[model samples]
Target: MKEDINNDRILLERLKNGDISCFEILYSKYSGKLYNYVLNISKGDFYLAEEIVQNVFVRIWEIHRHIETEGSFGSFVYTVGKNMFLNVIKNRMQEYLYHDYIIEHASELDNTVEKEVEYKMLEEQINKLIEQLPPARRKVYILSRVKHLPNKEIAALLDISENTVESQLTKATRFMRENLSPYCEIIALGLFQFYVS
Candidate 1:
């Protein structure tokens, strides 16, 4: 294990020097373990956890050229991964609290029956917007986002490539933006606040 760690450090140096093969080697070595770690902590919210993992890798790759050795590369990567996971959890919790606030205050309206009816109507509209997506894209979105499957698992379940699953999600998001413009705008604003602050 000590020798392996030394080799990994060398590979990380090569990766920092823009060696694609070294980067691939590091990815192949660690992706599964890191995915499982994130998945475990996320408690089945695999889609979000997967996004966190991707962000961690992207950040590492972007800053690799500047990351002078102050510690083990593995430890640095794991620290990045942990921080990303914490951010995701914090953002999700805030979103949950906001949704709860909306629901609670909505229930306190004087015209409770009317408010309920309006809420149901809005929910129906959102469902309609989702339905407007292409069949495959809709399925992928539902399974990955709603069902909370990781991309690899989603690919296996849908008999498609992980890249295809990602592509479908991108299309699904575009469709949602076009069809549910108002809701998309609101969500985008909320997400900006969630991440930027």
Candidate 2:
């Protein structure tokens, strides 16, 4: 154990000195263990575990220079993973809360001609933006969001992995959010139903 810690310290030192190969070495040593650790913590969410593990390594690579070279790599990596898991929980909670809030407030925004027109315009703009996505991404977004297909269904229909379907949807949503900004929320709450229903 002592020798292993010593080796990790040396590897971290090399990482800090900009030896990129050390990052790969550390990843090889720790990634599987980290994946299983996060998977257990996430209650058997394989994709979420994989995402968290990948993010943990990306973060370590980003902050390698600032990391202390003489400490427990296991502890450092685990701490980062734990924080990310908490963040995911927090974000998911916020999403549910926001969705509930939107549903509750949806009626307040209903039956107003001006707002109706505005929402229609926003929906049109959103469709245009989606059309601008790359072909594969656009197809995935249309199938998942417009057609209201589940990721698994979209994957089967499109002959892609569920991960790829998820990736495309994420990118498409991000692009719309970036481009549409404040109106995207309104569309998410209002026009989403209008289009789907």
Which portions of model 2 show Cα errors greater than 4 Å? 1-6, 111-197
Q: Report the error of model 1 at residue 4, Å.
A: 9.2
For each candidate, the alpha-carbon lDDT, in order, equals: 0.67, 0.76
lDDT of 2 by residue, 1-197 (tens): 34544488888888989888778889988999999999999999999999999988987786677677556888778877877787688658767876787688877756668776887788788788987999999998887666554565466556678999888888888787777776755665545543322
Candidate 2 lDDT for residue 145: 65
Model 1 segments beyond 4 Å from truth? 1-6, 107-197
Per-candidate total of colliding backbone pairs: 0, 0
RMSD of 1: 11.8
